[model samples]
Target chain A: MIELDVTKSHVLHQWKADSPLIACRFSPTGDHCVSTSQDNRLQRWNIADGQKVVLEGHESWVHALTFNKTGDQLISGGCEGRLIWWSILEAQPKAIRSVEAHAGWIRGVEISPDGGMLVSVGNDQVIRLWKTDTGEKLHEWPAHERHIYSAAFHPDGQHLLTGDLLGKICVWKLSDRTLVRTLDAATLYSPNKGQNAEFGGVRSLAISPNGNEVYAAGTHKGSNPFGAVHEPLLLRFNWADGALTKSHVCDGIPGGLLYRAAALNDATLTAVSGGSSGGILLFFNATQEKEFHRAGLPSLARDMDIHPAKGLVATAHFDQHLRISALFA
Target chain B: MSNRARYACGSMDHALSRRRFLGASGLLGASGILGGVASLPSKVAGAIPKNDYRVVVFNMHGGLSQLESWDPKPSTNTGGPFRAIATSVPGIHISELLPKTAKQMHHLCLLRGVNTAEDDHGKGAYMMLTGRRQTPAAEYPQVGSVAAKMLHDDQTGLPGHIIITPGGGGGRGNEAAYLGPKFNSIHLGGDKPPQNSNKPDAIAQEAEERRHLLRRKINEQYLSQRRSAITDAYTHSYEQALKLMERREVFDVSKEPQAAQDKYGNSELGRQCLVARRLLENGVSFVQITHSNYDTHNDNFNFHIEQVGEFDLAYATFIEDLAERGMLEKTLVVVLSEFGRTPNINLYYGRDHWSKAWSVAMAGAKIVPGAAFGQTNKEGTEVVDGQVDHGDIFHTILRGVGVDSSQSLIVDGRELPIADPAAEPIWKVLV
Candidate 1:
C-alpha cells in the first residue's frame, strides 16, 4: 500500500509527454498515472519508475478519461467525441471498443464509484450514461442550454452532477434519471462573455463525498468579447440545503481562470488553467476565507485528478509535463 | 416604426470629422476631383456600364484560424477539434464547421497561401485592405474606395461604396485618404433605416422637399466661389449622403418575404449579408461587411464554431441568392482577414497571429470555381509553394471585378499603381 502523508508541498514526480497534456488520472492502485495529450495519445506512466507506455487511438485531442473500478479497463473521450475503451490489464494496452458517443467534442467523462456506469458530457449539449461492462448506452438527456462541460458522480453513486457553459449545475438522481435540483452557478461563469464560443464554461466540477455539496469552477469576470475571463472562480453549493454557500474568486491574480476543481476534505481544490498566462493550483476551504495551499504551474493545467488513497494530485499541463504533488504528514 | 434596424450615417461623419476636425485638402490627390474616374482605363470604362461588375468583401476583423476555416490540418497537433470535409471539388477540402460553404465550394477560389509580412492587427489590416503597407508617407484608399473611384456611376441613384457596420476597429480611416471622401462609403446598418432619412412624422413631405431645394440653392452659391477639388469633395460627399437618404428604403428588408430573411439565418452576419445583397442588387459598386471578435487568444475551437457557424450559413446563402439572381457572374465576393492563426497552438488553447500561409476565399466573376490554389507545408507552418502576398491578393481581386490595377492615382504629381506594382494577379485563379 502507498503511504499517506500531509505536510509541506513539493513536486513528487513528473513525466514529460512533450505535448500539451490535457487530462490526467490516477490508476486504482495509485502506483500509476494516465494522462491524455493534445498529441492525441494516452500515456500511462509508472509513478515510481518514471517509465511510460503510449496507447494510441484517438485521432484528435483527448480531453477526458476514466478508469473502471478494477483499474484494468480505461475509457477516454476525445475532441471527435469518441469513447475508446482500453484494456490496461495486458502488458501492452489495447483499445477494446471505440464508440462515437457524442456528435461533437467530448468535454468530460467519469465512472460511478461502483464502476457499474459510465457518464460522458459533450459540446453536443447532451449527457449520456453507458454500461461499464458493455458499450450499451443506458440513458441520454439534454443537459444544458449550451455546451455541457464536466460531469461527475457522487461517492454513493446515487447522484450525478453536471455543469455547463451557461453556469448551470444540474443534479440528477441516477436511479430515476430525473433532475433533483438545478443550481444557477452564474458566479463561477462570466455572464456577458460566457455565451461567446471563445470562452469555456464550467470546465471542472466535483461533488462532495456525501453528495451534499458540489464545487464548480471555470472563469469569471469576463468584460468583453476579445479577451476571455482570466479570473478563476469557484462556487460551492450545498445541494441538501439548496443554497450556494460560498462563491470564491481566486484572488491575487488578475484574469486568472479555473479549469478543473475537486472536492477535498472540507475545501475545494481548483486548477487555474491560465488563459494565455500560466496555470496555478489553489485550495480553498468551504468558507472561502482560508487557503490551504497554492502553487504556480509552468503552463495551463488543462485537467487534473486526485489520488484515491495516497492524497496525491496530478496536473496535466500544456507545457507537456504531468506534475504530481502529495500531502505529507 | 421599429427603431431597432436604423443606423444614421451622420454618426460616422461626426466620428470622422472628430478625427479629422482640421480636414485638410488632399496633399495626395491633385486639385481635380473628377480626375479619379476619368483616369480609369478608357476602353474598360465604357464597357463597365454594360458590364456592371460589383464586389463584396467580408472582412473578418481579427485573424481567423486557417486550420479551422479553409485549411484543415486534421492529423496535426494544432488542428484542434475540427475535421475536414470534402468540398464539391474532388480534392479540395475545407473545415467541416463550414458545412454549408462546403457544398458551395464549386463557387469559390480558395487561396491557401497568403504571406503578408505584417502581423500586428492595425498594420496587417491596413495592408490587407489597401494593398499598401502602413506607411507614414501617405494613407492609401481601401479596396472599397478604389472600387468606388473606378466603378461608381452616379446614374445608379445609389452610393457607389457602402460599408455596413464600418466601426469594426480595422481602423478604417476617414476621407478615403488620397481618394477623398467622395469615394468613401456611406455607412448604414441595424434595425431601422439611416436615422433621420425619413423626415419626422411631424414634417410634411413638401416641407422636406422645400428644405432640400433651399439647401441646393445655397450650395450653388458656395460652390461658385470654392471650385477646388477640396470644395468639390465636400459637395460630393454631402450629395451622396443625401442620395442615400432618398434611397433609404433599400435598407428595410421587411419588404422581402419572411422566408427570404429566414434563409439567411437571422444572425447579425446574416442580416448584414442580406443587406449586402440588397445594396449590391441596387448598384452599390463595393460593399464591405465586417463581423467582429475572431481574436480567439483562448478557446479557439469553440469560438470558431460559433463565429464560423454564423458566417458559413450567411455567406453560403448570400452566394446562392446572388447566383439565383444572376448576379454571381457579375459580382465578386471575397472573404478576407488580417492574417491567419499560428500553426503553433498556445497554452490557452489559442493560436496567436500568423502572417505566413494564411488563406482567403473568393467567388464570382473571373474566379476559377472550386480550385484550391497554393499549398502550405505539412503541419501548416509555412507556404511551400504559390506564396501570394496581400499585394497579389488585391491585384487578383481588382482583376476579377474588372478594376484596372494598372490605373494610376495621380496624387500630387506622383503616380502610384492601383495595386502594388510588384504584385501580379494569380492568373490561374482567374477565368
Candidate 2:
C-alpha cells in the first residue's frame, strides 16, 4: 500500500517498458498488478517491488486486459482480433485458451464476477460473450452500427452494458442475447436560440456497483459545430427501468478530452473519474450526499482499476506510469 | 356572413381583383372597400406573389479571401503570391487562381467590402447566413426560409425551398425560425440525390389513378375535420415528395455531356453545384449549397489552392450551364463566404480568422454584370469604400431577386424589419 502526498501529486511511480502501456489492473488481493502494452506483452508485477512476470504470445497491441473474480486467470483481447486466457501460476503463466473472436480490433473485455463468463466488444460492431473455462461461445449480438468502445458485465452477471461510437448506450440480456434498452443519453439542445444542434458521440461509460445507475460521457467541444474539442457529458440512468435519472454537464472541465472512469465502493457509494487533461479522482460521496471532492493526481490517466478486496486504486496514465493509491478511512 | 363564406370570398376577391381594388382604395385602404369587410379582416396571409425574384445562395463556409480570389491587389503587400489576370469584363481583374470565373466575370458583380461581426466559425456562419446575431429565445430564419415563406406556391408540387449539404463542419443556421418546421427547407444532406426519391415502378404506372384516389380520401377526411393545418401541411409535403420523385430523371447528371462533367470536375462540391443547377431548373424557388473546410489556420497556401481550383471550375460551369439553358436571367447566383482570413500569415504559415473586409460575387437576375461594388485598402485589412455588412449584402441579394428589403416580419409581439433595419442595398449594382 502506498501513502503518497496529496499536495505533491506530481511524484508518480514509473513502470519502465519498451512499448507504450495501454491498460492496467490490480489483483483482487492487491498484491500483484498486471499491465498490457503495445509491445505485445502482458507483464504481471509484484505490487511491493514492481518486478515483472512477463507473459508473451500475443502478436499485436493488447487493447483490453482483465482479471477474473478469483484472480487465478488473466484474459487479454487484442487489436489482432484474438482473445487469450492465461492461467495464473507463479511457476508457469500458461495459455489455457485462445480464440479468433472478432473481425476487427477488440476494444473491450470483461469477466463476470463468478469467473464463469467472458464478454468482449469490438470495432466490428458486435459483442461476443464466452464461457471463460471451456472457451465455448455463449452468444453474440449486434451492439452498435459503428465501433463499440466499452463493455462490462453487470455485478449480477445476468446483464451486459455497452457503449458505442455513435453515443448509443445499450443494455443486453445475457440469457437471450437481446438488447434490453438503448439510450441516446448524449442528446444536447442548442444553447443559442433558433439553431438546431446535436453532439458528436459517446467516449466512455461507467456503471455504479449497485447496478442502480450508469453514466455516459459525450465527445465534442463547444456549442459551435466547428470547434474541435471533446467535452464530457455525465448521464445518470436508472438501470432497472432504463429511464434517465439525471444528466449533468460537468462544468469546469476543459474542451479536449481522452480518458475513462469507474465507480468505487459499495455501501456509501462514490466514483473515481479521470481523463486526459489530468488525473482527477473525484470522490462523489452519497452517504451524506454533499458535493464532489476533487482529488488531484499528476498525469493524465487513460484507464484505472480498483482492487476488489481492499479498494486500492491503480491508474494507467499516458505518462507511462502506473501508480497505486491506497484509500484510508 | 358565415366565417367560412367570408374567408372564401375574401380570398377570391384578393386573387381576382387585386390591381383594380388597390388602385381604387388608395394608399391606406380602408376595410369598408373590401367585401365582407366587417366579418373578415384584411390580414396578409398565405404566399404573397410580389415582384420579388428568386435567389440561389452558394455558401462557401471557410472564409474565401478577397486578395487570393475576387478582389486581387497584385501590387499591394497583402496581394496574392500569384498575378492578377484581366477578366471578360474590361477594367476588372481577378486572381489567376480563378481562370474560369474570370472569363465569366462579365456576368458577375463583386462586393469587395463586406464585413461581419464575428471571426469564429459558428458565430460568423450564423451572422452571415441569418443576417442577425445569434439569440437564445428566437431563431431568425435563414434567407431561404424567408423567401420560401414569401414566395412558396401551395400547388407547386416541389419543396418551395431546398438546402443541399446544409450542415457539416459548421452546423446549419439555415432553419425556419418562428415560422416553424413546415416552412423549413428540405435539407438534402449530401450531393447525391435523396435515396429512393424516384417514383417506384408501380406508382409510375398508376399515377393518375392514385392521385384521384388520394384526392377522394383527403376530401373525405377533411369533411369531418374542416381542413386541419396539420393535415394540410402533411398533404402538401407528400405531394411535393411525389412530384420530386417523378422528376428524378432531372437529377441524373449522366444525361449531361462528358465534356460538361470534365468542365465541372468530378469533386463532390462540383457535383453538388451541378445538382443545384438541376434543382433551380425544376423550379425550386430557393436553394443553398454549402461548401466547407475553409478553416485554414494551417497549410494555408496548399489548402487554398486546392479549394479555389475546385471552386473556380464548379462556379464557372454552373454559370455557363444556367446561361446555356436560358435560366440565367431568372436565377440569381450569389457566391458568399462567412468572413475572410487574416492579412498576415502566422508562424505555422497559416492565416487566422478575420472579418474586417471580404468579397462576395453575384451573377444573373437583375444584378448588373461586370461591376465591382466596393473596395478594400492596400493591405487588404479594412474596407476602403462603400463598406457593407450582413444587412447590406442581404438587402442587395434580396433586391436583385425583386424582394423589397424594407419589408417587416412579426416577431415577439412586435414588427421587425426583414433586412438589417439600418442598412440599405447597394442599388448602384442592380439594373
Candidate 3:
C-alpha cells in the first residue's frame, strides 16, 4: 500500500515576502523554480539551498511565467501587456527581449515545440503569434468574442489550441491563422444542464507527449440563485480535428478552481487546482483507463512541473511551499 | 399640448379613426379577419391590410411522449399505460389526461410524424428551435426571431417578440442566434409579471414623468447619432422598450377576469399562455411560452400523467380563451417538442430518446381544423407515411403564417435556405 504521511513527511519551504505570489514555474533542468509575486518581482530560488535570485523589472504584478522548450530562456507576462524574455546563460542574467504584445492584460503565454514561435492571448480577445528569436509579430487572429484564458501550441508546431471565457475551444491553423474546428465543452457535462453551462470557459490546457491528444480543463458554476456550484472538467480532444473525444469530471478536486495542468508522460498527467479554500495535486494515468488518483498534498497548489529526465513531480502552492514526489506503482 | 391643439393635428384624427374601427370591430375579438387575410389568394396580397396576423409557439422543452399526449397508441405494447379518448372533432382522439384539450380539437391540426437528425437534447433543441442543423460558420435564427425580423413594427407599442420563462432547457440559441443580440427575443426570466408592470402606485406617476423627459433626451441623442448602425439598433430597442413599458396592462394577468383565469387554469404555464395571448392581442408579432420538465427518463407514466394534466388544462384553456375572445383565428398556436420518446419502454420503465417518429400539433391561423398530417408504424416506432423532418416543419410553420418559406439568408457570401432545401410543407395541414 502507498501511504500518505502528512504529519511527519510534509516538506514546507517558506519565503517571507511583502506580497502574495501569483505564479511559479520550475526550470527545465528542475534545479531551480521561479516565482512571480504581486510585489512585482520574479524570484529565482535554488531548490536545494532555498536561496533566492530576484529579478525586478515589471511595474505591476507578474501574472504568468514559463520556460522555453530547450530550458535556456525564461518568459514572463504581466498586467503591463508586455512579454519579457530572459536568457538562461550564466553570463546574461537580464531580459534579452521585451515585446509589447497586447492591448490588455496578458492572460496566457506558450512557447512553440521547436522554440521558434511564441504565442500570447489576453483580455483583448486576440491571439498574437511572434517569432521568438526577434520578437517580430508573425500573425494575429481574433480568437474569440470574449477573453481567452489559456492557449497551447500543438506538438508539431503547425497548429494552436485556445480556450475562451465562453468555455469554447478552437483549433487554429498557424500558417494563415484560420480557425479549423471548434470543440463544444458543454457536451462533457451531464446532458441535462450541459447546454446552460457551455459558456464557462477553459482555464488550462495540456498536450500529450506524442501530441495526438490535447486536454482542456474548465470550470463551470451551476445556475442556482445562491451561486453556481463550481465544478472542474477535463476534456480530451483529437489534436488534428479538434474533436472532443472523451471527458472526465474532477468534481471537488481539493481546490474547486483548476489553474494549471501538465502531461507527465504519454499516459500520466498531473494538475494543480484550487480556490479560496485551498488546492491539491491530482494524478491520472490515461494508459490504465482508471479513475483519477489523488496524490493528497495539502496546500493551495497552483502550478506544477515534471522533470524531463526523471519522474519527479514538483508543485508550487500559494502557501509559499513546494512539494516534490515520485510516482510509485 | 392642449386637447384642441392635439385634435387640430392630423395625428389625433388617425388615432380617433383607429380607435373607432377597433371599437366597431369589438376590440378585434374576431379572428375571422386575420385568418381570412392569411388564407386570401396570393394575387390579392396587396388588398389585404397590414398587421393582421400573430403567432404564439408553446414549446414543451423536452420531448413529451406521444403515447401519453396527442397520438396515443393504446392498442400497441409500446403505448404504455395511457388510454385514448374521443375529441369534439369527429374521429379525433387524444390522451385521456388532456380532457379539456380533446373538447377543443376542432382548432387543432396535430402533425403525428415529425422527425429530426439529432437525438441529444442540446443539438435537438437547436434543430427544433432554429429549424436547421448545427453548423460551424453560422447559427440559424429561431422561428420567433425570424418572425420578429420580418414583421416587427416600429410604431407598435409593444415588444416585437418575447419569450416567457426562458432558460428551461437548451442553450442560448433560443434567442436570435446569427441575427445577433439585437434581434434576440426579450426573455422574461420567470413566471412573474414583467418588472415594469410591477411598479408601485407612488412610483408610477413620478416614473412616468421621468420617462417622458428621458424619451426626449434619447430622441435628441439618436437624431445626432443617426449615421451609426449601433446607435440605430439601440434606438430601436429603446423605443420598443418604451412602448412595452407603456403597455403594462398586457402583462398584468391579475387584471384578467376570473373566468379567463379559470379557463386558462391557475398554473404558471397557464399564466404564461395567457400572457402570450395578451401580447399577441396588443400587436406583438411573436411570443413563445416554454413549459419545462418533460425529460422523463424514468417513471415515464406517472411523470407524463402530471405533465399532460398541466398541459391539457392550460393548453385547452388557452385555445378556448382565444376562441371566446375571437383571437384564435388570427393567432397560430403551435405545440412542439425537441423530439419524442422511444416506442418501446426500457428496463428502467422509461422511454429513451427517439427522433424517428414524433408528433406536433398546430391550431388556429391558416391551419385546417380536425386533421392529422401523417402516419406512424404499427408499433409506433417509425414514420410509416408522410414523414416530415425539421425543415418540413419549418416550412409548414412559415407557410401557416403566410410567409414565403423559399427565402434564404445570406451569410459570409453564402446563401443558406430558410428551410431544408429538399423538404416541402405539409400541404394537407394548410388550407
The DockQ ranking, best first, is: 1, 2, 3
Give the winner by DockQ: 1 or 3.
Answer: 1
Give the 10-residue window scoring lowest on summed lDDT in candidate 2 chain A: A188-197
For model 3, what is the alpha-carbon lDDT of residue B380? 86
Error of 2 at A189 (Å): 37
Q: What lDDT score belongs to each candidate, Candidate 1 first?
A: 0.76, 0.65, 0.67
lDDT of 1 at B386: 80
Stretches > 4 Å off in candidate 3: A1-329, B1-50, B166-174, B178-182, B196-227, B408-416
What are the clashing pairs of model 3? A167-A201, A255-A274
Residue B293 miss distance in model 2 (angstroms): 1.9
lDDT of 1 by residue, B1-431 (tens): 22111111111323343344233333214312332432211222223332488999987866878899999998677777688999888999998899999989989999998899777776787788888786755667789888877777787778887777533221122536666666665656433455566657887989978987998899899888866665666666567657777888787887778999999987877888888888888888898887765777666777787788888999999988998899999999999988888888877777778998889999998898888899998789899888898889898889998777766666655566678888889988999
- lDDT tens readout by residue for model 2, A1-329: 45422222232345655444567877777778888754567778777787778888675557688878888888888766799988864655888889999865687888887888888987688988888888899888777876687787778778888887657888888888788888765452112111112224444566778877776654444343223223445556677787876654455555433345566644332333343346655444333322255556676555567664564667765455677765543
DockQ of each: 0.40, 0.01, 0.01
Candidate 2 lDDT for residue B309:
72
Candidate 2 docking quality: incorrect, acceptable, medium or high? incorrect
TM-score of 3: 0.49
Docking class of 3: incorrect
- TM-scores for candidates 1 onward, in order: 0.91, 0.49, 0.49
Clashes of each: 18, 5, 2
Over the stretch B181-225, how does candidate 2's per-residue lDDT look in tens digits? 456566565565655685556666678567858886877777577
